[model samples]
Target: MSMSTSSMSAMSSAPSAFMTPASATSVLISGAGPTGLTLACLLARQGVAVRVIERAPQPHTGSRGKTLNARSLEVLADLGLAGDLLAEGRTGLPFRRYFDGAFAAESDPSADTPPTPGAPYPASLHLPQDRIEELLRARLAELGVAVEFGTELTGFEQDGERVTARLADGREVTAQYLVACDGGRSTVRKQLGVAFTGTGEPEPAMVVGDLELTGLEPTAWHQWFGPQGALMLCPFGEEGDRWQVQATPETGPDGTALAPSLEGFRRIIARHTGRDDIRVHAAGWLSSWRVNVRMAEQYRVGRVLLAGDAAHVHPTAGGLGMNTGIQDAWNLGWKLGYALSGRARSALLDSYSEERRPIAAWTLETSAAGMAAVREGARTPGVGLEAVRVADITGLSLGYRGSSLAEDLLGGPLRAGDRAPDARCTDAEGRPIRLLETFAGDRFTLLAFGHRPALDPAALDLSAHLRTVTVDTDDPAGLRDTDGHARRAYGIEGDALVLVRPDNHVALTAPRGGEKAVLDYLARL
Candidate 1:
């Protein structure tokens, strides 16, 4: 019916020295970007004490990392913040391109694909990275945790028991675990001596910045390609005048490109577009970008772990950078919570690296291929933005099928480690509810199917960490799959049970009487 009140209370009120002035916190997360903020919100929702620190004085102003893929949006929706993002973000915005200052073509990459009942968000959302962080901060604040800005993790040391970190503000914090989401040049990763192996582009590829510009409509993403290079101005931020400027650098006679500056940006814009009417009034957050593909060999060292860009950094071609990092946090949050709660062994955290490291490797490959496609398109006439491949960028097809956590006792269309699909169902009162709504909270979900009988949640010995829902075709008292959407999505025809993880991946599948297999799967974690 509901979370076992006694079990939840016992776990939440578990005695922790973390509340003491000496111990400080349960988890100490460095870098208040999406990765750290998402992990903090998840852990806080489970009543775990978390401390987040950012070296910057305030929130980042630039509209950096603007794309949120469908998978990341689903995770945000589970956290109850997707509504705010969808309300503010623009979706299905067509690409308006020009060649040599003349109109070329307009195309929408996500035009063919539409949202399905199982996958509601099929298109990506275009929103500034800063706004995403602001929403996450608000959610974190509601959970009674505030990100400490200007507080830097200068260094840290960890043993088998705990982590002791020293901040630039001369304060030392002690926590059960430490996580680094501090971007590509992570000090923690460097201190851990993890090898970041990959090649880098020697030359500056592009200059990106946020600016206030006129002569540009805020309706579509505008691109200008000419002899000098390519320039793209996409409307973003909360105001009508704001836009993100990305342009190729102008090479001098000496074979060196000019560095990114406001004057340089204006000159490049004028030369590329062959128009001086597009005024650049003010510029902010300018930086020269180069293609660097690198990944950490391992994600965890002792009690300190790496996440986000700290673990991997790849080309910014398919907008996978931010989404990959956000998903990384989602995978780790629950494992960390289980470990800290003492309900699971500390070894459970090792799966975090085993499962996610391969995904990052795959992302590096996908993004590199996407970058190559963009380059090939640039050389071909009339290719325009259509050259950027739009397949699998949504991240919906990704799964941990090879993971050790995946248990395959019963074979079916959806196997262990597959993403659990959502379906429309109803309660005994005939009220409609989505499958994702039932899986939203940070807990394992057990879906028991068949008309014969159901495994009781209280008998599972995981009532504190699990929720059980019975799906029966004939029983009016259970969840009514009137349209058979749940059964069709899961490919179920008879009595079966599905166990889902906190990250919404199927842990295992079994027959009606196979309760031991379910407990064994969770015990391995």
Candidate 2:
């Protein structure tokens, strides 16, 4: 599992992994965007050789998707980049909704109830896509991994054992697996001929320039649902006081196929704010994109798999697009690393599509509904007027179901496919630490409780290959109440041990006395 010096050099030299040798390329990820870069960093940390390819010459500076949920923050924390990101990024505090330029409802993320114990990250953070990429790139550089830019995957061929991708420069690189993080127009997805079944709703909105307001009071996020469609103004960061404004375009048929002009953008802003003197700084990024709700027919076609926008594309109403992609990579990265390291069976790869596709479908539907609500509000002023629930807008409620791991858990509260909640606990040294802090690095965790006299730790000797943390709890009442779902999910109650996967899902739960059963489970994996 050692990374070759040549692969390290390739990551530092090229924008894509095309220059890296096949022997050094265990995982070849196309597109070094957030999802691909995050996956590369995760694999590299685990001693897996990962090569990332991107068509863009360098990191994109556009103000694209700009919301990160608690789940995504947890994944970043695992990569050791969450602290830096939180410092650089702004928190979506005092969550508020505006109707016709009037405040409707508001709540603070920090004031919310603490998550059930054992969960990793429990709140959302607001960071622009560019800033997030910057953090991810910094992390990859720290791990001696760099994304190869200006490299495009022209074509690819997958065999029984590996996948070989042909680059635009006529270079061929082979790897054990090929992941497509290339955006909505993914060539890999098209090459596989997987149907992207979805329709686009015409949004005749011309979101104008990155303006720095003088008199406009800036809060968390301002959404205006007037007769003129939805106008959303979101704060980017402290520097320059950049704000992204989205409003309906007076010209064109529902704003379809109409180029966004600065003049057109200014008019929309003036119409909404009733101020024509607002100074425009610079149009950092501007484009009109109609909402497209679509998901790949399949996430995998042999060794070639799809992730991020390549797998699904939905409206930005809920800001779930980027977050969903990152989660996909987080789930797949560890599984691929473990399986490639010969610790798990190839069938483990099937779970990627099984667990992720449905989630993507749900995101698409949810985002579509949100967009429909917004559009309806635009058409019939204040028709569907209701406070935008934080869960709906944040995309935190999305979870996995219908997997073998989940199905085995039955209808218990802590069954498979449920997110493992976080809890506060004291370590051996009596130092207070969070359960997520235990999973900070990329590794698996095992939680053990109850009084079992003959439990043998040596039965799970894979510790050298896997990370194991055993929390021996004598007083069940001392355990975090949020752990009920975790206990039920693992089918463990009193005097039991539960093995958690790297993604924080329960892998196996066994009674504390049944060391043999636990050993058998590890051996099977």
How many residue pairs of model 2 clash at the backbone?
Answer: 18
Please give the RMSD of candidate 2 to the true structure: 6.3
- Every model's TM-score: 0.92, 0.85
Candidate 2 lDDT tens digits, 1-525 = 222343223323333554444344898999988899888988998899888888888888766777787788888888888778778776644545555655555556445534444444435667778889988999999998888989887776665887777787867788999999999999888877778998876664345435556445566666566665666667776653777766665566653535676666666667765665666555667776766888988887777789999999987766788899999998898878888888889778888999898888878877777776767765543332232233544344555645665433223445445666566666555666676766566565656655433436676556644454555554432334233443443445566655567886666555556556555666776
- Model 2 residue 28 lDDT score: 94
**How much is 151 displaced in model 1, in angstroms?**
1.0
Model 2 quality (TM-score):
0.85
Please state the error at residue 400 of candidate 2 in Å.
3.4
Per-model lDDT = 0.84, 0.69
Give a tens-digit lDDT track for model 1, residues 169-262. Answer: 5567899999999999997787777788898999988889988888767888888875656888889744548888888887789988778888
lDDT of 2: 0.69
